[model samples]
Target chain A: MTTITKLPDPVAGGSKHPQRGKTPRPGRGRRLGDLRIALLFILPAMVGFVAFFLIPTIRGIYLSFTEYSVLGDPTWIGTKNYTAIFADELFWNAMAVTLQYVGLNIGFQTVIALGLALLMHRVAKSTLIRGALLLPFLVANVIVALLWFWMLDYQIGIVNEIINWFGLPRIAFFGSEQWAIPTIAGVNVWRHMGYTALLIFAGLQSIPSHVYEVASLDGASQTRTFWSITMPLLRPVLVLVLVVTVIGSFQVFDTVAVTTGGGPINASRVIQMYIYQKAFGESDFGYASALSVILFVILALVAFIQMKFLKGNESDLD
Target chain B: MKKTLGAVAAAAAIALSLSACGGSAPASSEAKGEINYWLWDANQLPAYQQCADDFTKANPDIKVKITQRGWDDYWTTLTNGFVAGTAPDVFTNHLSKYPEYAAKKQLLSLDDAVAKDGIKLDSYTKGLPELWVGQDGKRYGLPKDWDTVGLFYNKAMTDSAGLTAGQMANLDWNPKDGGSYELAIAHLTVDKNGKRGDEAGFDKNNVAVYGLGLAGGGSGQGQTEWSFLTATTGWTATDKNPWGTKFNYDDPRFQESIAWWAGLIDKGYMPKLETTVGASLADNFGAGKAAINTTGDWLIGQYQSYKGVETAFAPTPKGPEGKRASMFNGLADSIWAGTKNPAASVKWVEYLGSTACQDVVASKAVVFPAITTSADKAAEAFKAKGTDVSAFTTHVKDSTTFLFPIADKAAKVDGIMKPAMDAVLAGKKPASSLTEANSQVNALFK
Candidate 1:
């Protein structure tokens, strides 16, 4: 093993005096080797960031402050686009819808995904059950939305047929304002919960068998052991899943666009759909970029708050 | 293992950056040698492809490539292509889209091309050639096809209701009482208990079959829904066509017409807005659930499935203007300004607008050709198909059709009015809800 080394404090102004004790340092070659390996490993990610994310994000910010329709030279018009976005009623409505969508989606996805994961953990022939459950997530969002759209058709849908069999009035799953968002949330949960469950299942598997054995030896009941052990250890994974789910939920566009087309009086028009209309429908790229920037900020703030509120320290694992 | 992973990472970084740089520039070639043509409507694709084949056969030196994209994707892709300087040499253009494209100078002016080729502008449908002219008096495209709205009704329902042929043919309407038109529709609507809308004990809440359906959200252009009624009241979308800068959505005549139309929902004459969620009016009509549908002529074939449902067409009801009217809209072929093959591109556009190609287009009976002679041929062809297209053709022969509104801010106007109209149609709000939307539309011009 390489020995740890210490160097003289550079902040103290290195002195040649004998009273200034010699401090040991790590081997220079080894440190350089480590740095070189790290850079090599990180370079691909850095390139992808700069090319796809960083460059586009920077350009988008610049475009937001200009009057651009993507056909002509961008005219500088500082803050005009942002001001318009703030004053637009549709923007606020979209924001409200998006937040509602995110809350509902995360709520459904978390509870159902965790439950499924726990069930899978305790079941036999889990591989087959897990594979069958993940089938929905494997399908594309557009396909899922379309399939659900047909399945929920008021006149000819299987779902409505079932409702009719129950002697209940047929529900307009996609047309009614009250049901559109919830229907979208249900479809989103159906398409994503399986993936989330698989992730949580992986986290569950990482817990050592000894913990459960020790808890059993202590005469702890099944529920008590789960609350004391599984819940505590699963905190990090839950936080990660929550953050990811939040980000995904905010950027949802395809589901709403395909199923509702943001209709029934814009009841389900989320922020991304609003941005898309501005960008493509109105051909107002500058305003769309401004909206996109605002959305990015919203997502970042949400993720930051989630991290601060839910993340436990490393010592929590012990 | 670490070394291998590091090498792989470095290679990936280099490859990604190189790929990014590689795709920034599209390979552009001499345009005249090989021209790209694009269209959106899949139904019209095969006809245009035949035209392309014939054109290529005549001009051995030049080649043509045709691309078909769906409606929404087409516009988005074409706009992106214009920005990227890789737009096709010639493409199909809509009346709503060309104004903005022309204003931006992304479209090539065809004035010189028309004069050089001695193309007769008047040979096309009335008012169509003028529709392609930009606000600057420059022609940017040539009319390819035209369409008009008409009444599509289920014959079985009307027969059962004992509606006379004359009543259906000469139905007149007014914003005040809906005239004979409302009477016919009310006679046709039935409740779950088999009670007609005009009958006693008819439950409006439990309507089994609606008399009519105004499909699609009644956006600013209620083309087939309320335009005919509003037009008879002397209402127009804007002050002028081709380059109207203002929208007239706040006109009381228009508002009253919309109110009357939406009121049909409450009166149980029309389907509730929620009923048209995933299914189209054509589908509903074909399924024998709706008695009547006032939609574009293009949907006639779609509705005439011959599956125990007998379908027939009738001219749009005469409005208080003392004449029948429909919204006359057409599509055209336009050349990109950046096309290197201007000569060939204009040639293709002129050919598309010519009687020769249009006659071939008519034989397909997919759309009414822009040229009058070709349009007549289309009617004859439709007759051969055992379909009566005179409902749409009559407007053209009588010259009672109004131009579909075109303006600099057409898309903006649509975004503003669609939601407002949705509210009105849903009965959550009255037609007066369009006042704010109208003001916003007018503000776009200012």
Candidate 2:
């Protein structure tokens, strides 16, 4: 895996240039040959990225400034779509609802995952338990949503049945406006918690064991150790997790789509659901594209802020 | 860097070319090749496959390839196909969707084909053929099957409530008070403590069986849910039938009917609107959670399939209009504008609408075919299966059915109305809030 290159500064690095041209030429040629082979290996993925992701993103941005209804050629309308979106009450509601869902989902998911990861670090590290925890994440979003949907049904669901057994009133989990978004957030949190836990666990594993040993020797209590050692060290992993999960939760669609379809009255109409409804349901692709571009900007900004403010790349473990 | 860029560029070019291949042009009409057919109903796939088999037997030159997707996927895929110019040569069309397709010129007008083929418009049920005519007066499709809504009741639940079959059939409803229909629903509902909804000690919250099952808010159309009730109040959805610009959702008659319908939730005679989300109304009825559910004739087989549940149909209760009203929705087969074999596609669609294929479809008893004789045969087929579907047929017989509203901006209209109606049904907003929604809907046409 090593590469050798001829040094241009022979006088300054004379010792390093002893075997310059003769040996390094072949090495450099081999490196170039290896680069070609590497590019060939990655060609398929590169093509896919360009065609599906890169091209569509460009097309989507272009379409955001036009009126495209899928049936006909797009007609440019400039900032009309964006202007309409700004004035749209539903758009604002969707933003608020999506933010609420992201807050609840990421908040609960990260807290629970951190606890689970810490538990795995301390007590049990069985593969079976990790596999079991990761099972819900493996299930399709729609399937997970439906499973929880039936489980949380107002009348007949098992959750309500248990609630009734305690003499508590049945909750209209997906039915009522107040409970819909939180219910959807809870469903997604359940689905994603284990995967996030495993991610944090991997970060936990990477932290030098000697660091924790030194902390224990220094008579740091479990609480002090977690706050000072574990929390600070886990910052990078936690930031990445937050960035990923927050962006993901903000685009919540399938769970809300299957469960409430944005309502008892637009309660769970997350931003993505609104975009989908605009594009596919209402055939207002221009507005939908504009909404998506806004969402994309928001997500990018959120990630940037998370990375910068938390100093995500500069690991304390160093 | 240059070498890697060259490789990436070559790969991207190859990928673009490969993606471009997906939008292959339809086969030229000169070549009598295969005609791709698409439909949503899995239950009707066998029947349609039989027709395709028979169609190939007669035509031999044109092969029919059938694709069936679930309802939601079907429309989405078809819409995507239209954009890609890869849509099937012929596909099952819904009344809700065809107007939008026709407006975009994505559907081929069949007026010439219908005239050339001598397909009698009168041969189909009374309004089936007319429903397919676009606002431009060009036929976009030929009617394949028709459905009308009716009351599907749990027979055992009704009988135990001291409700006789005659009484069930004759129940009347008015928006002012729910009339005998509400009384029947109340009497049919039972609490866990064995108290009926009309009984002195009946617990609305703890009811063991709801009197009626809700089928969501029914959005703009309200086809099976409250359309019959609203129709009786003489409140049409639009100023005109097919291409009406102004919506009538703000009409007092419509608002009153909606208010009364939502009131059923408060009265605890019906399941809460929230309970129906992600739940099937037919399943709820079959499970005996509800004594009655007003649904379409298409679900006759579904209700009948529930083992040990005796299900019967009652005509939608007589509305204030002095007759029971049902929304008459008909499915049609339309030729895609971009079809390579227009002749063959038209031929297939013609055969589908003809008695030859319609009778075969009728025999399946899965749905009532559009052709008058075929629909009669379908009713007989249902009778042979030990299910009398007169409650559905009687609408057509009595001419008490109204067309499923057809108009432009149908999706946008539904978007506005769904939440508006959901709010009303959820009891968060009064039915008067629909006036704002109505204005929003009307604004779309402008």
Candidate 3:
């Protein structure tokens, strides 16, 4: 498994066309012999990725084109699945819900995570605080969802118990359609806030203390130091977080499945839940695949746009 | 290097083939070998093992090996095995799933097998055999047992309500406004805060125990909601498609059921949704917190282990609809079509369908025996526990149960129905909206 070369060969579409000297003539720089050896070195990983991730992804897209149930063979119905998805008000509703979820996750979660990261950097490096902060991330996602579900249960929930002690009317955490999404989003944020902070923390840690020291000596105020140095530097890490969190939000299934089950009437029904219910629950694999393709397209477009803007920010860093 | 690759690939191929061939039947001419059987219950393992023992003692050629798993895991593992074609020789099957599997030609149709062993559908209950038949009219399983819901009550709670066990044994409603039930519930109501449910001066909020216990946790066995309400409305759980096509949650009758159901929760007659959902349902009733809990026939053995609590059974209290209804479901033993020893598996089922084993199964009270004659054994066992279980048997016989159709889509519909039912019962949405959702679900079936 050793990477003998400093730079590995590009095996993007994979060993499907394994002509050793198959690189386009215009893009050739790393020689044929080097390419041959590099392909040999990367063959295991190249095969593994293609077999596991790439092929399935391609199949998923192809499936998005067709109608497939997980049990039986899928039939090619061309754009019918896609057409159904576009026409589905419920599916579109889920999409709007997902976009809202993504926006809140990226918009609110980013600022909060960055703020926490900044606070953590100011404090002395202590494992107690570091470990204590990362504890939420350590708990399994399903357990966290269940715990929050119990905490927020309307009638017998601890949340209502506390609220009732103060002689206030109980707010149903997931009871009402309005509160359910926010409550789910809140749980999602709590679970991932630690990971986001940790991501930005790593970015923060990489920026040498001398940069801050130099800024301080330049008479940079705490505000200036943060905006000028920290914020700019954290942009790369923040972009990574934003992209992942957005995608992760689209992939939110376990929480909704366990907590509300896409309910109070499909208010929290994200595309993933819909896709799953169609695919596994209903055995409408082709329809599910079509929904999945829509999900992929949405995710890809968002990622494209976000990263396009992010790449602009990143270039300013270099 | 080439030799090494070849050897590794060869070893892997050999290992796979070995596991693959492990599922095939041993040659009859050859010596005896062990066979694996999978069953779902943690408790019924012993009963099955005893059957295995009896089988092996008579026929020394096959040594039966049994691996126990819970229902959910068993289904997951069963699905995986079905895809892989390494499923067990004998396994438990349900009416919900058998039809779909049988339709796919996955299950070994026991028709020929039944004939070979001199077993007949008439040997068991009439309704039981119908459960194992798929959409194609193929008999995939032998009737294992059937389940019907019965109203179970606490003697202590009824005693406090000034009701006698004798009066309740043959209790009936006058079919007008459920005034008889309201009176019974009033007598059963005791106010911890000294406010009685029956008294004019009593406060509904201050009442302690409710007359009828409906549901505990969230998604119960569908007994509290579907049986009490949906049956009264004259609905069977099927859409145009086999999978759930209609979500009748928005039906006025259904909503009325929910509102009536909510009254139980509203009046402290039942535990809140979370408390009544799982193990705590049994525990809550066992502690005498509530008087009567609506449950299925399965809980009879389940409640037997409860400490300091002797349980009794009753029929579901008739509603204003004048229909005394019960939701009936049956479980059957299906043979795998791809089984190496289909003949032997059929032999095993013939044993299962026999009066001897059915009697044992009934005597254990694991489930309401699907066979009528053996079901008497279950009734006798329940009578020994001081609770008459004949209601389960008689209810199925007397009442016309709108049974689950073996549509290819039934299992899938159930998945959608459970959560939708949960939403309405939880009061997250008003009962009126259930019809809209139910219609939308019906559209899916269409």
Model number 3 iRMSD: 9.6
Q: Rank candidates, TM-score, best first.
A: 1, 2, 3
Error of 1 at A128 (Å): 0.8
Docking class of 2: acceptable
DockQ winner between candidates 1 and 2: 2
DockQ of 3: 0.12
User: Which structure among the candidates has the greatest TM-score?
Assistant: 1
- Which candidate, 2 or 3, would have the higher DockQ against the true structure? 2
**Could you tell me how far off, in angstroms, the CA of residue A310 lies in candidate 3 after the best superposition?**
3.6
lDDT values of the candidates?
0.84, 0.86, 0.67
lDDT string, candidate 1, A1-318, tens digits: 133223223422354443543432323444566668778989999998776677778778887898866655568999999998899999999999998999899999999999999988887445788898899988999999999999999888999999989989899999988899999999999999989998898889888889899999999998998899998888888888888888999999999998888888889999999988988788887898899999888889988888888873342556
Residue B23, candidate 1: C-alpha displacement in angstroms: 25
Rank order by lDDT, top first?
2, 1, 3
Assess each model's interface with DockQ, reporting 2 decimals per model.
Answer: 0.39, 0.43, 0.12
- lDDT, candidate 1, at A156: 89
What TM-score goes with each of the models? 0.90, 0.90, 0.82
lDDT of 2 by residue, A99-150 (tens): 9998899889999999999888777778898789999999999999999998
Please tell me the interface RMSD, in Å, for model 2: 8.1
lDDT of 3 by residue, B103-201 (tens): 555666766656555676787777678677666666777877777776677776776667776666555443223346546665676666755576766
